[model samples]
Target: MAGSRTKGSDTLRAAQMYYLQDLTMDAIARELRVSRSTVSRLLSTARETGLVQVQIRSPMDSAPELERAIRAKYRVDVHVVPVADSVNEVEVMERVCLQAARTIGPLVDSNAIIGVAWGATISAVSRHLTRKITHGSVIVQLNGAGNTQTTGITYASEIMRRFGNAYGARVEQFPVPAFFDQAETKKLMWRERSVLRILGLQERMTMAIFGVGSVDADVPSHVYSGGYLDEVDIDSLAASAVVGDVATVFFRADGSDAGIVLNERSSGPELALLRGVRRRICVVSGESKLNGLRGALAAGLATDLILDEATARSLVESDGAAEDAVGGFLPLDTASGR
Candidate 1:
């Protein structure tokens, strides 16, 4: 037992010197009064015993070519999470969400107000967040979660609680239906002080976190599957040629929401208001969301995008194909100014 303990101690020490202290094997060997080969063995043992961990992170996460292509074409920052082609859509979301949670920490600071859109992707992301304490920071829900079937407070609150716990910040929930029965009702509600307070918070947001909603996704978007939209509403969206949504405001394939009709009653902030945010981080995964993602990009909904490698590759390929067919890539409004 004593001999094993001594060997473990030696391995741990060698690993600290080499990895943490940046000491070369020669220096470690000399300091320990042992041979370079022995030092190498100790380092190897450290790794084998789980005393040392090495992570290789590329400038673009893992897909530099794809990220660069997307960035150049979309005029937005891109991070492509490395995921195997054969992985299932659920697994893809898990990986992308994990990476997004890690990436989000650095973009926030003291007194930052963060707008969080609750959806399947964002919910998954909330589960993986690493604690990042910030003073006077607030995490506010970007859209209402209530529908005819449920209040949605429980589901949305759980997601918000995770973020609040992670950041040690306060949580603010939006109390309203995902969409009102009438546009006039929505307009009236907006005039209320309580409702206006949430909207006011949204305007002051420094960062906005969201995910594109697609009805066709393998894992259906929460808004589509959560009873937020009825058959009549779904049919309306279809007739209007809606492709996807960000924060419950649906948009067409061309990124135009003008004729969607449903926009007037949406409880979510307007695209213009979302653009006013300094940093908008959009997270997506799975090829099923490809068209929706494209619509979101064309709408200039995101300033920074985090997506899985497979989705990123598909995005690049489809865009290139569209550019070929159109003779050029179409210019976007880029409301957030990239």
Candidate 2:
């Protein structure tokens, strides 16, 4: 009797291993000295007795339909960060920033020129970059880091210092304003030999990292908070139906630079210029930034996007989010209403 009971218990344990631990049925049968059929029966019993339960976890489980819609619509690399129900906008942005930093840190290479835009979101990303120094690299501020209220160079300098410290590379600071008072002023400044030298370096950038700024972003936009834009500029942006900006170049909800005057005075590269770079990474957060994020995608300003899950889901579900424009999955059907 003892021998028979021991054999049955061993069979049950084998079934537990096979079903619960995902061990092959054949392997379990061989180990337990039982027929395959017997192993199958034992597994069935284990399941029926609630000893085994299988579950699959998907990143898109929170919004499956949204993920499918974004994938089908944009067809670019999109990372939808997951957000907890109780999280605030600041927390969301932090999560997205950290994720972006983690993603870009490993992609950095020796002797590479990394073009970076100035903003709170990018600042957050810089704080999270913890990679060890492995290459001779250079961090170049893409746009003039100064603004009307203060020299934005300090913020950019701090960010570059951190990056250089991590990789033991040199840092280049662009000491110009985010936008000049007039287009002519910008045109004349571009002619300066020193300015031209930095501009030349931008053309050879290996990777460009930026952040999208929404006029009504749930979290305070860096442009607004950093004093880059004054009341007049903000009013002008609003009057022009500007939705968002990448590096101070404003775009409409459909990603068109239709009526925004600031784009001409902006220090960063134009949309076309940014497209020439190999990698363009845009980091964004906040549900209110959905339209802005969509605008960036429509303008071909971003090759890779890092966003909070809630914002990503919202972007995916809204047909207006991924308008067709500038080739790629999102086509530019300007005739259609946004």
Candidate 3:
């Protein structure tokens, strides 16, 4: 028994060096003081003994054709919420958020640090979140929610509170405007050590949950309709060909963020930073948000998507004949890459 265990240990070490550390078989043979063929045999022994295993991810339980198309097109894990076409906007939103809650709820576990972006859709998500027993988890506000009329605590705090309570985790409330009155003010605030602490937490985020905001949605995004932007803001977006935003950082349909001066004043993390999070779960409701969702996918913003079937169908539809023949499975025009 002891001899067999030692042999297995050597095999595992050799396999690790060759496969994981990318060492040449010659090097492994040299280090193990064995012939090249002997090194290969040990590596093969590791596989035969079940020391190495490969798992091919089975498809998730979701809309088969739609999910496959989305996975192929955007390379995102998609959950399509089937709803009747006649469902009212309010009912549709509730259903979508319920799916969001169920999808995100189980992911809450030990030591998870989740970043949350606030908005009408997020507000709906908070309400639908399922309580779970977790410890050392935290929900941090991704962006400052204060507008000119209020301090933002009443709203953004409430949202975080729900998530915190749901997961039995800590909550960190960001107290700042959704958009600063001046870009310089935001720059200066970022310099403060206290502010830097929160930014640090963001860097360590394991997961992020957010809603895509669009100006055209029938169920209006709070930021677009809630006095967060003025005539100048609207004009700037139009002038720059902006479509929608994630965490208030606006982007065009092409998912390019360059030269949009409004981003300087926006309090949200840059798309690059948001993309750094391991799992980004986005909840979307309306067809009006299609351009924004396309931009988000193009920017590599989401790893998981929770959306209604109607919206999913709209997103998959394309004008190309090949795409049509493929059942709208072609890559989104705005997508960065599959």
Query: What Cα-based lDDT does every candidate model obtain?
Result: 0.87, 0.76, 0.84
Model 3, span 1-338: residue lDDT tens:
32445665678789899879999999987877778998889887665433553323336523567767777878899988877789988899998997788778766677999999999999999997766657898888999988887777788888999999988999987888899989999999999988898888888999999999998988999899888899998999989988889988898876888999999999899998998999999999977788888888887899999898788888877423446676654445434543
TM-score per prediction, in order, is 0.83, 0.76, 0.78
Best by lDDT: 1
Over 4 Å off in model 1, which ranges? 1-62, 334-338
For candidate 1, the per-residue lDDT at 136 reads 98
Reference-based lDDT, residue 97, model 3: 91
lDDT of 1: 0.87
Off by over 4 Å in 3: 1-62, 319-338
Tell me the tens digit of each residue's lDDT in model 2 across 149-222: 78876778898787777667788888898889899999999999999988988888888999988878778777
Which pairs of residues collide in candidate 2? Answer: 81-309, 111-136, 324-330, 324-331, 324-332, 325-330, 325-331, 325-332
Please give the TM-score that candidate 2 achieves against the real structure.
Answer: 0.76
RMSD of 2: 12.1
